[model samples]
Target: MENNLKNRREFLKEMSVFAGATTFLASIPWMKAFAGSDGSAMAPSDRVRIGVVGVGDRGRALLMNMQQIENVEIIAVCDNYEPNYKRAIELTAGKAKAFYDHREMLEMKDLDGVIVATPLHEHAHVVVDFLKAGIHVFCEKSMARTLEDSKWMVDVQKETGKILQIGHQRLFNPVYLNALDRVRAGEIGQITQVRAYWHRNSNWRRAVPSPELERKINWRLYTEYSAGLMTELASHQVQVANWFLDKIPTRVMGSGSICYWNDGREVYDHVALVYDYDNGVKCLYDSMIANKHYGLEEQIQGDKGTIEPEINRIYSENPPAAPGIRQLLHSIEKGIFETIPIGGASWVPETAVPYRGQIIAPYDNNDTFLQLVGYVQAIRNGKPWKNLLREGYHATVAALLGLQAMDTNQILEWPAEYVMEKDL
Candidate 1:
């Protein structure tokens, strides 16, 4: 037993070091200043007791981040898979109780919140159950598999008045937050269009482990457990577009195909979507699996400027014109010297500028930790959660609509009664 405990501690230490390295490399300039030596400004005694459900890939990552935050405790962990359950126990250094069923974990009176990292399809059911149990939830995104399920989660959240923060980590990313502020502040002028794409080379192939474990590990490739690229990848971009536009998409149209990998996977390997907002703005998005040369990119193009959140690039179409002696000489010797376009109505040159925007709440790469901190802080301060349940519902709905558009080969419209739908 002592040896087991020692090994668990060693595993946690290794995981912590790995997470720290990733967090360091992916660090955002704005977030670094906000992350103190001991994480944020929260008191250690006020730590939120957390129970994590579904200890899969994302679940383990969340566990590592939670460990870094000072005012947070992993009280319990639940996973149906025995290996994952054991792994979660090891990851938490045996500090958290383990359970096969999430319901059993939720029954623990000490837990102040829960992190739902279950498969996409089970998101709504598990989140609603925990919310109804009067426990705060931080569920991973694409919140649900279907539109009906997403709406249902929203309704239950409203009824329970519990904090339901969906895990769209990008929403809390410092760079994205900075871009959003610039968009909202009109630095990018009127956002006429958004272009986003995520491309990857090679078939999204995984080892086939005895048919049973096939669905267990790579649930993403199957429709039963996941919604493929549309939900897994495009959902993040859709949420960002929504946040920038400050409105949900009115209509969605798209298509997808399984051109690259023919591994008996039900979901498409590539997908593209066009979301039309009520204000006439549009978001064009595409994801491909055959080639990733372009990698992942998102550009918010406006009349005045463009912002690329991923690259941290911001540029203005209107640049300051040259003046004084240079302008005078060019005007005098038109034949000898070529006329340069200056900042005027007729000629505008795109020029990159330092991003001077600020995020509403600065996020570092440790956003997951910051979000957990925020949730715990809100609970301790008796304040409402900054990330509301409706946001998660909307993000999920948009993702599901994108999938529907692809499947039905028609534009999917958001129903008026979407908010009132009951969870399945």
Candidate 2:
């Protein structure tokens, strides 16, 4: 009995600190990760009780994943929208209490933590109050709608000493982890540029059941609730660039226009941004709702090789030599000049793979579930990740900087206040 319980505890601890926690699970496409550990679940009384606020699309998905964990019980769900509330409670099979007002749900003293999936603007209040209530909080990314609120989150977490984790699943992704390891190891020669994009073909508008709910349903399309593509899409890659380069962007410039989707939307349909780092490296990002041709990607380019992390492939500029036997035969047959025969087709260097190339990891990367697994485990241990706060804060500020640059039509330097701890 003691051994069994000890093993379970060990596994739970592993779940918390396993960098690229799901790399192995993601590589095994045939297997499903129902829960992270193999040992028996903790007794009901010993389980971690959690609540979820704002059961919108992202929130509901988090609840669904949270429900699958073995010893974590979702105690409550709060969503102002009836449909979203209905959907979330149904996932809990009505075992979890439903509330329209988050204030009421936070009153549960026994709740160990809560997932704050509220709209961008609502985050500061929802998260801060939960922190004050002494509940570990897992808030969704784009920390807050404005810069001051975003920084306040980090400050409050430090002051309160509560577990605060931001939802940027890729930080726990195995593919990115392995790629990050390689980049730092000089796998790709000195890093030069990072390019990222997320493009889709849709008007980006939600159906308004009534005229009153137009802005509420599609909060992502308005400046009041969101920063559009910068917040919605580019934020992920911005963090990746920062992580890979080990520095925040020193300055940023951007532009946008409502090119295709003219459906009474305040945010732009197309956007472009360039963020420069001090070391002559730059992170280039662009997004458009008008085209689906270029789906999404974060491509990191170094002098010797390029890693298209989204697809997991690494391409090389200088390939390795072929097998000695094959090389000997080819050298003899082609007279050692490495030349094309007369009257033959064009001769070209071999592709990247036939020499120095590989997938960052041998798997399809699905990291969201693993990230949540880490969060639940963190709550159990009463300690959160050190980098999660910074990942969420800096990336968000970078996105807001892009928005400011676009709005003002000028290159914006990284704020001096933010630059105090680190060189810009």
Q: Whose lDDT is greatest here?
A: 2
- Model 1 off-target regions past 4 Å? 1-45, 321-364, 382-387, 419-424
- Report the error of model 1 at residue 21, Å: 28
In angstroms, the error of model 1 at 311 is 1.1
| C-alpha RMSD (angstroms) for model 1 | 8.4
Residue-level lDDT tens digits of model 1 in 329-418:
667777565555554443555547443532223223545655555455455554434434455667777877788889899988877866
lDDT of each: 0.73, 0.80
Superposed Cα deviation of residue 80, candidate 2 (Å): 0.8
| Model 2 regions more than 4 Å off | 1-46, 321-357, 419-424
Cα deviation at 324, candidate 1, in Å, is 6.9
Give the per-residue lDDT of model 2 (tens digit) for 191-220.
899999999999887788998898999999
Question: TM-score: which candidate is best?
Answer: 2
